[model samples]
Target: MDTLLSIFDVKLAIENLPFVLSGLPMTIAVAFLSMGVGALLGLFLALGRGSSYRLLRWPTRIYISFMRGTPILVFLYVLYLGLPEVGIELTAFQAAVIGFGLNSAAYIAEINRASLNSIDTGQWEAATTLGIPYWRTLGGIILPQAARIAIPPLTNVFLDLTKATSLAAVITVPEMFQKAQIVSGRSFDSLTMYITVALIYWPLCIVISAFQERLEKRFSRYVNE
Candidate 1:
């Protein structure tokens, strides 16, 4: 008990809780902003991947493959550190968002592609026979069904992005883990600070997971109706 208490330092954790939590907003901001960018770009990539034109399909395929193959940390470093050498400057926050966003887009594009492809071919034929435009059919009929299929995997991506925001600390984005590091340095209690941050991340992930369950249930109900 004494050894554990010395290692954990509950009092220190409690005292630093608010300071660590002060970075929550930045963590959430990076996550959602990156998700927004990923979703939008990913959708276009999905569409291009399925396009008949070689120009579109091949390029999107290459982009997705390249992004997925690389580690996100290296990409973040490239954007935050390397870009300035090329005369393109970006702030730490901007670099984190763009790096995570672009990296996630590859994964999201694959998910979107699979979901879109799962829809029945007959639906497309039926819509075409009805003289509905491709865009309208996609927007009205296909995407809604595909979205339901996508929710689970997309939620997983979001969960990952949320946790992955901690990596932004490397770029000095001042997120939760970064704050924890500061506290650890000041107090000389790295184990306690890290454990505290992990506890904070635990509840945050739990909330996201619970929200995902609710979203899945709601979508299931819609589908049933």
Candidate 2:
């Protein structure tokens, strides 16, 4: 216990807590911003994947395949480092957000596609028989039902995105992990800083998971009725 305490440097961790926490806002910003982008892009990708036109379907399929196959770290490097070679310089934050957003969209697209597909064909038929336009049927009837099925998976994606924001440190985005890295370097105690950051992430994820449970229950109630 004494040896562990000596290595961990609890006093240093306490002292640097504020500095480490200072980056929390940026971490949250990157996560939400990336999620927003991913949600929008993923929705369109899902729709495209389901479209009747081969042109739309094939391209979306290729995009999803490529994005899913590639490592997100490489994508981030391409955006932040490789793009500069083509005179397309972006700030670290911009690169992080765009990279994470694009990568996450592939996963979200699959979730959206699966959710949208899960709605019964009878619902579509009934809407069509009622003289509802395709868009109206999709928006007014199918999507709401599909949303209930989607909430859980989408929340999982959001949770993953939130934690994955730590990868932004590679490009020098001043997020929580980056701050923790700074603290670790300054204090010469990598284990404690990394553990502290992990502990911080644990509570944040727990809160998000609790919120997911409430959201699932709320949506499930609507479905039950």
List candidate 1 segments past 4 Å from native.
Answer: none
**Top candidate (TM-score):** 1
* Per-candidate TM-score against the hidden true structure: 0.97, 0.96
Among residues 3 or more apart in sequence or in different chains, the pairs in candidate 2 whose N, CA or C atoms overlap within 3 Å are: none
Score candidate 2 by TM-score against the native.
Answer: 0.96
lDDT of 2 by residue, 94-168 (tens): 999999999999999999999999888998899888899989988888878888899989999999999999999
Judge candidate 2 against the unseen true structure and give its global Cα lDDT, from 0 to 1: 0.92
lDDT of each prediction vs. the true structure? Answer: 0.95, 0.92
Colliding pairs, model 1: none
> Alpha-carbon error at 17 in model 1, in Å?
0.8
lDDT of 2 at 177: 94
- Tens-digit per-residue lDDT, 154-194, candidate 1: 99999999999999999999999999999999999999999
